[model samples]
Target: MSTPILEFATDANNPCMHCGVCCTHFRISFYWAEADDAPSGWVPASLTEPLNPWLRCMKGTNGKTRRCIALTGTVGQAVRCAIYSQRPSPCREFPVYLEDGRPNPKCNELRAQVGLPPLPELPIAPANDPDGTPTEPPTEPPAAA
Candidate 1:
């Protein structure tokens, strides 16, 4: 299903506080071709060592429990994507607030840490049935805005 774009307030009043928690916890998967297309800054420690060419997941180290290799920054510092411009397709398409209308745990955690209320749910498709067929089509959120 196509992901919805969550509109964020972009004025100076809505500046990112830079807690750096999201980049530390999420797992970002990248396609092999996308990894190859990464820019110079996106090079991780794993890429420097000899390894199999067909590998998929490159686990993060040092404070970041298990995250994508491309994420960089120490805890309490400004977290940033090494390849912000040339990020992988998944990174480019990440939901700003929700993933398939479900509240992303990482995002929710960050919001709660900052004392913000939970965001409203978005439209999303239901999970598949036992036989592997989709249970239902996407539905719109309630009109109470």
Candidate 2:
């Protein structure tokens, strides 16, 4: 039985600190417009390659190991996204914590790679879970519109 982290306090520090598994493991592709409409010094053209003419994606993600070009520092110790503020929607939307039911397998797998323990279940009341399974929540704060 894993210990549930429950809801994160507003003042709570990010649980993802020192964990960069998702940044290095995922493909991180997104629509071309994300780059097209972004302000200067945001998602730079140099860090991305065309996924297709209609899509753009992070570089360094094409190789077997699949590390994002934006990743800096060491995994499981200290790390950060170089373009976190201007990251593509997919990267921005990735889940970092488990919620009401079951845990995210990919998130778990990545956690294991970095030697972190598996996330606990949602910790919600049984009635809240129609199927009694836990879900997950987004990793970061939503970007302002």
How many steric clashes between backbone atoms does each model show?
A: 0, 8
Model 1: how far residue 71 lies from native, Å? 3.9
- TM-score for all predictions? 0.43, 0.67
lDDT of 1 by residue, 78-98 (tens): 345565555545555645444
* lDDT (10s digit) by residue, model 2, range 18-87: 4677878778777777774555325677788888978878898877888889888887656667776678
Worst lDDT run of 10 residues, candidate 1, spans 10-19
Q: What is the overall TM-score of model 1 with all chains considered together?
A: 0.43
Off by over 4 Å in 1: 1-17, 37-55, 58-64, 67-77, 98-106, 110-145
lDDT score for residue 35 of model 2:
79
